[model samples]
Target chain A: MTPDERGEDSAIDVPDALAALLGADTVWTEPPDIADELVARIEQEARLQGDDQPRPAAAGRPRPWRRWAMAGAAAAAVIVGIALVVNSADDDDREPAGVEFAIVGTELAPDASGTGVVQVRPAGFAIIIEIQGLDPAVPGTFYQGWVRSDDGDLVAVGTFHAREDNGPIALWSGVDLDDYPTLTVTTQQIGAGTGSSGEQVLVARFDGS
Target chain B: MTARDEMAARFAAADPDAIRDLYVQYSGPVTTVAASILRDPQLAQDAVQQTFLNAWRGAHSFDPSRDIAPWLYAIARRAAIDIHRAEQRRRTEGGHDLDVAVTPLAFDRTWEAWEVRRALGELPDDEREIVRLAHFEGRTHSEIAALTGIALGTVKSRSHRAHKRLAHALRHLVDTENVS
Candidate 1:
C-alpha cells in the first residue's frame, strides 16, 4: 500500500535527505568484512544441511542461520513477483511459519532411508530428514542429498549432515527440479571427491500435490 | 588472490582463518548494529558469531552476483530482534528485570548523531530499521536476512538500495563543511 513497499521511488527528497544525513559509509557498506560475513554464513548453512547430529552448543550460543536454496525455481509466486513478496512479509519473524520451499536436485546414498519432509512454497524450501536407526557417519564422510527428475537424473539441490533434533536440514542454494519426482540423500567423504560414493541413505517422493 | 579464486577458495575452505577473516571484517559494524537493536554488547557478540557461523555453513548458497553486506546485516537484525523477543518473553513470563541500558549519545547535540537520528526518523520504519542495523549496529545483509528470516537476496538488494537512498537524502548535510 505504501509507495516504498510498492518499490516505487517515493518523494525523492525524503530519501535524499535521509541519505545526506546518514553520509556514505553509514548507508552503503563497501567493507570487505561484510563480504566475509556473508561468505561465512552461507558456508555454515550449507554444512549444517549434511550434519546428522546436533552440534555441541558453543560457548556463545548463536542464533540459527537460514539459507534457502533453489527458492527462485521452487517458489514461482515469490520469485516471479518479488515485489509482492517484499510487500507481504515485511516482518521476517512474523511471516507465515509453515510455508514449504522447493528442492530442484539432490542425490541420496543408496542405503539411505527415512522419511524426509521438505517445506516447499513460494519463497523457498527447507529439508528435514529423519534417520531412523542409522549410525552417524565418521567425520571424513558425510551424507549428501540430491533432487532427481522422473527419468532418474541427479540434480545437486544441496548437501547436509544429519541432526539429532529431528529438525529438517535447510538448503542454502537453489536446486534445479524442473522434471523431478523426489529427493535423495547419500554418504560422501568430506575431501574424498564428489557425488554419493558411500551408499543411498533416504528418498522423499513428490507427487506434485 | 584472484577475485574468482578468492570466492572459490572461500567456498572450498571452511577453516578458522577463513572464519576469522569474516569476524575481523564485519564484526565491528555488526556489533554496532546489534547494539542498536539489542542494546547489549554480549547479545551483539552472540549475534556476530552466529552470523558468521551461518555464513560459513551457507557459503555455497550465496550468489556471487549480489553484495554480501546487506545479507549479513539482515541476519544481524533478526538475531537482535530475536534477543529482544526472548528478553521480552522472559520479562513477561517470570517478571524479570527489564532494565536493559540503551547507549546514550554523548553530546546530545552533536550534529552527527542528530543527523543520523533525523535521517532515521525520516525513513519508513522498515527502512529505518535496516539503516539502524547497517549504520548504528553494523550488520551485513546476510546477517540481516538470517536474523530477519527474509530472503538473503532481498535483504541485500533492499538494504543496499536503502543506503543509497539515505545517502542521497543526507548528502547535503555531509557535504557542508560545518557538519564534516
Candidate 2:
C-alpha cells in the first residue's frame, strides 16, 4: 500500500498533500538581501520608539542561540540565504520579481529566441522582453507583449518593433506572475482594435519561478 | 533556562541582534508556513519580514516560559493572511477581484511541509542532492548517477542514508499531536 504500511519509515507516513509538497522542487523564494532590510527596519523602529536598551553584538559563531528542540537538526546548519523568486502579479506593488523566461517564437517565427527579465516595481510589472530575429514594427503594425493568466486573462506589458539593431524592449505589466505566468507576443495592426490580433509572432510560458 | 527560553527572553526584551539571531534560525520554516498560505513567494517573504517586526513590537507580552516557535508562527500566519487580503483588495482596485477566498491549508499540512523542508535543509549536501534527484526529480539510480556524476552504488547507499536521516529527523511530525 503506502510507504508506512509497507513498514518502511513512520516519517514516510505523510499524507498525500504533504508527500507531494515534500517532493516539489520549490523552496519558498525569499527576496534577495531581505536580512539587511529586516535588520534596518528593526533598528529604525527601535529608534523611533526611543529604544535605548543595550543590544547584543552580532555573533559569528555557529551556535550563538538555541532553537526549539523540534528544529534542532534544521537550524543547526547555520543557513542564511534562500533562493530568490520574484512574483509581481499586482504589486509590480513593491519588491522585485527577477525570474527569467526564455521566449521562443511560434510557427510564425521559427528562428526567434530571447528572454523576458521581469521586475516588480511600484509602477507595474516591468517585463524587459527581447526576441532576436524579428522585424521592426512597421508603420501600420506593431508588436505587443502580454502576460496571460491561467484563466485566460491577458495584460499587455508593452509593445515594440524590433528594428535591425533595436535592443530589448521593456514592457509594463499590471498583474502578478503567480496568477499570470504565460507570455505571448502578437503582431498588432495599427487599427485592429485593442485585442490581440492573433498573428502570433512569439510566445514564452514561465515554466518555473 | 534552556537556550530556546533564553532566546525567547531576549526576544521579549526586543534585542535587535537577538531577533536577528532568531530570524537566522527560524526564517526558513517560518517562510515555509507563510508560503503555504500566501503562495506568492515575494508576498510570503513580506509576511515573514512583517512577522519578525510584529514579534518585536509585541515582545513585551511574550512568556519566556513558553516556546517562541508557536508565538512566532501565530504572528507569521496573521501577517500572511493580512498580505493575502491586501493582494485581494489590490486586485479589486484593479477590477480583477475574484469572488472566492483562497482556502488555508490544514495546520498539520503546513506543519508537515515545514518539517520536511527543514529536514531537507539539514541533510548533507551530497545526500540532499541524491534525495533531490531521486524524489524531487524522479530520477532513477543510473539516471541520478549520470546526472550527478556520482557512482550508482554510492548513489544507492547515499539514498539509503538520506532516507534514514530524514526518517529520524522527521519523527516528530508524526509523533506530535500538540502542534497547532
Off by over 4 Å in 1: A1-209, B1-17, B101-180
Error of 2 at B16 (Å): 0.1
Candidate number with greatest DockQ: 2
Candidate 1: TM-score? 0.31
The window of 10 residues in a row where model 1 chain A has the poorest summed lDDT is A81-90
lDDT of each: 0.48, 0.64
DockQ of each: 0.05, 0.12
| C-alpha root-mean-square deviation, each candidate | 21.7, 20.9
Query: How well is each residue in B35-130 modelled by candidate 1, as lDDT tens digits?
Result: 555555445544554566666666666654565555666665666566666656656777767676433322221334334544454567676666
Tens-digit lDDT string for candidate 2 (A56-127): 223453221111111222341232122223333243423333445677889888888887665434323456
